[model samples]
Target: MSFLLRLTSRLTGRQVGTDRFGNVYFESRRLQPIYNRPRRWAIYARGGREPTVVPPEWHAWLHHTVAEPLPEQKRYPWQQEHRPNLTGTPESYRPAGHDYVGGTRRVTGGDYEAWTPGA
Candidate 1:
């Protein structure tokens, strides 16, 4: 995959920018086809769900809101860092900083205990 990207990049003369999640972004050197929006220069990236994994700096660049890619510029001090959205995975969106969720709630809806009449 890297080889193909490197080859394409070489042919186009655009450098690859590696984001925080190992995703790569590139700008077109030839402006071959702009079918998506037709007016803006198309920016591309190799990514999966939740583009936040790309980090704030790269996110700006990926959307063409910024001109330069990461490693060249930096995140602001007040800007919070990136953490992949983990809503479904075992290791995702947990209360603690670390540790995976085991998916077992201690109390179930039907298992409530009734109070005794005279305790």
Candidate 2:
């Protein structure tokens, strides 16, 4: 699959850059026809939705802000590579102010607990 992707990219030949996440990007090899709309598409790890899914460093690369791929030998003190969110996974973050386990809301004095029919 990777081989196929590389071959297609070679044919298109606009590959200006790649990101830390290995997402390769390219501009149009030929001048786009006046009527042609810009392409807004990518193959993501879980699924592609919006640009926010891509973090700041990678966002810059995708937009051509930096000429080189991430992790250039000369490290910038502030520059950090992209890291995709894992909100839905067990490894997701639960900060000090956040809730890990939910408790039910009860206005009245009632034993509010999770529903289990047999229990």
For each candidate, the alpha-carbon lDDT, in order, equals 0.55, 0.54
**Least accurate stretch of 10 residues (summed lDDT) in model 2?**
37-46
TM-score of 2: 0.44
**CA lDDT for candidate 1:** 0.55
TM-score for each of the candidates: 0.47, 0.44
Native-vs-model 2 lDDT?
Answer: 0.54
**Clashes by residue pair, model 1:** none
Please, what are the lDDT tens digits per residue for candidate 2 over residues 1-119? 25675577667656665555555555556644773533322333334454556656556665656654455455578966455666777778766544564544435666777799988
For model 2, what is the error of residue 38's alpha carbon versus the real structure, in angstroms, after optimal superposition?
7.2
On TM-score, the leading prediction is 1
RMSD of every candidate to native, in Å, equals: 7.4, 8.5
- What lDDT score goes with residue 77 in model 2? 83
